[model samples]
Target: MIKMALMALRKLAEVILAAFTFGIVVAIISSAPAEPTDPAIWSFEDTFLFVFVYSPIFFLFIGIPASIFIEGIMKKINLRNCVYTHLVHFILYVSAGSLLGTMVALFFIAEGFEVYIVVWSTIAALCFYVALIGLNKIIQFSKEHDEE
Candidate 1:
């Protein structure tokens, strides 16, 4: 039982580290000044004048984690050892991101934050698809590499 506990803890650590990676990237991007000329980049990365205003939340909640998860799956490390670890990580991200977006949107709604829910939801979907494809590629590469 102790061994199982330790492995679970390790998986948790991986998730936390991945989340942190995404949080850092989001933070850096959020801190930068807005560039209004671009179409979609503006929404998440300084679409509004106050994008930086939400910088802390973006980094702490979203950026670091995502990157970590992406890196882990890409490297093909823990998937074999910790069954369901990947699924759990995927759930954690999608749930966490949605939760954050919903909470923030609520706060904004009070202050007249005029972003559409559909737009933010699309962002969530995009994140999911991107991760899915990337992981698939990693799996494909791993198979090819091992065949030799």
Candidate 2:
């Protein structure tokens, strides 16, 4: 049971780290100066706060619950460990990101919604996916090492 708890903690860490990375990459890449002499819209401090602080909060509210629901469904179907599951997750993340980003952008932006939303959302999805996968691999390696 302790081992299970440890693993859960690790997974939680993985999620938060991935979310932070995604936030940072998205914030940096999408940042732009509003005027020739003006500061970038997403300033360094804003990015830091958004990436390091708000990300975990958003992940708790949005990511964890969604992951739990999806994980339950995946476990039910016995596909949690299948090789194709990663691909499915990648596709799902991209699709959901695109849809949600587009909707939110549409509400706030009247022009150029297509470019920023679609591109950034896709990039964000990719960042999250890659970060999670890389972190999971590291966790798995450490677990194996501990067992040895």
Candidate 3:
């Protein structure tokens, strides 16, 4: 029971970290100058503050449940090969990122923010996937080193 709880906690930590990283990347990307009239109007401080405040709630309500569902599916499939495991995880991360992006875009739209939904969503998803990939690599490296 304790082990299971620890595993769940670890997963939550991973998702939260990934979500915050995604938020940061989105804020930076969105703050870029788009046109002569709209020259990077978003304030970094404000964006970070907003994201920091809301991303955990969003992740807890949406991202974590979705990831747990995907993990359950993977376990049900009895996938043991490392390659298959990595592939499944990649798909999970990308899908989660896309879902998160869509939700964020919808929120921004509802709030009367003047932003391109598709662009921001895609950027957020890509940034999230990349961050997860980096995290995965680091974890793998550490595991390998520890086994030596």
Candidate 4:
């Protein structure tokens, strides 16, 4: 129980860190003009503040559940620690992210769908994956050091 709690805490930390980084990237992207003549959609500070504030909620709702579901599937399949598992996980996350973005864009944003919504969500998923993997590596290293 304690170990599980620790893992959950670690995962939450990873998600928040990933959200922060993802927000930074989104802010940069959203603040730039898509074309030479077009004005940027937002000021950098405004975009950053909005994303940085809201993105953790988005990830907490969507990302944590998806990750837990995926982990359950991996465990059931007896492939949680397999060498090729990360690739499968990556594909699953990217596909899910794309589908989610499409749905959100179609239903919420406006009358027309924006491609950048999909792009940003996909990037956010990738950010979460990278953070998870990095955190896992760090934890493993720390465990090994403690054992030695």
Candidate 5:
């Protein structure tokens, strides 16, 4: 029961973090000075719309399915090894993050936004992966120390 609760809490944390990061990115983009006569550039309304449209699609279509698949694979392996489990989780997280980021960038490009989609999306993915990895390591280390 405790483990299940903890899992729920962790998932909640991940969602919150993703939303926060997305908000920060939107804020940064929105705060930039507008280029006169650049219709491709995003206005504040455009940024908000992008976020509003993309967030649910990302969570529902990409994030949830990827997470479920990864979890299923991990469970099937039944490996009682933290290192292997962490590695698999890290790789899966990176893959999902990258895929989602790329999709968002492509969507923006398709909508006629003049942003540097590849560079920004890659950076976003990397940052998210790094954050997740760091969080995982900290949790693992804490659990190990507690066991000791």
Candidate 6:
């Protein structure tokens, strides 16, 4: 029920991650591109920057606060809750990102618009990072309150 720049950011980050995961999970699992230097590959300009750059960066944005919330949901002094939250966060992220990505992909498919993996990844990474930090900070502050 939260309506703030933070929630909007979380929603956006989740959507982007879901979409990218939808696009790249298939690529990463099936093709197994080893290196950008590998000439035999199908160009990972999109994959690397998107998956590696954006996804991990999202950890800082969505992941940290997500970790805190998961901890709250778990409601225990155990570290397991933290781990569980991270796993759930990642899964949620993929789910949302994939849905958005699929819709976009369909657009690309119909219009024959080339998906610039490089461009998409680059933008997602840049935008999502700011959102991630905001979320984690909220979690951290809340955690302190919980401790007191």
The runs of at least 3 residues in candidate 3 whose Cα sits more than 4 Å from the true structure, single-residue gaps closed, are: 32-40, 78-88, 92-136
lDDT of each: 0.50, 0.67, 0.65, 0.82, 0.62, 0.51
Global local distance difference test of model 1: 0.50
Off by over 4 Å in 4: 28-49, 80-83
lDDT of 5 by residue, 57-76 (tens): 45445555666676788789
TM-score for all predictions?
A: 0.35, 0.65, 0.60, 0.79, 0.47, 0.33
Off by over 4 Å in 2: 1-8, 31-36, 40-46, 79-83, 99-126
Model 4 worst lDDT window (10 residues): 32-41
Window of ten residues with lowest summed lDDT in model 1: 47-56
Report the lDDT tens digits of candidate 1 across residue range 1-148: 9998964554444334433333444446455345546554444433333432443344434544654565566467455545476565666556556665666677757765545653453344344434444645766799899998
Which regions of candidate 6 deviate over 4 angstroms? 1-80, 113-130, 142-148
Candidate 1 vs candidate 6: the lDDT winner is 6
For each predicted model, how many residue pairs clash, with residues at least 3 apart or on different chains?
A: 13, 0, 0, 0, 0, 10
Per-residue C-alpha lDDT of model 2 across residues 49-72, encoded as one tens digit per residue:
677675566555555555555556
lDDT of 6 by residue, 1-148 (tens): 5568766666666545544553465355446444656666555455545455546554455444544464455455343576666565455444444444555566656755445533453344333433454556767899999999
For model 2, name the residue pairs that clash.
none
Evaluated at residue 25, the lDDT of candidate 2 is 80
RMSD in order of candidates: 10.0, 4.5, 5.1, 3.6, 6.3, 10.2
TM-score of candidate 4 versus the correct structure, residues matched by position: 0.79
- Deviation from native of the Cα of residue 37 in model 5, angstroms: 11
- Candidate closest to the true structure, highest TM-score: 4
Q: Say which prediction, candidate 3 or candidate 5, comes out ahead on lDDT.
A: 3
**Highest lDDT against the true fold, candidate:** 4
Q: Model 1, residue 127: what's the lDDT?
A: 47
TM-score of 3: 0.60
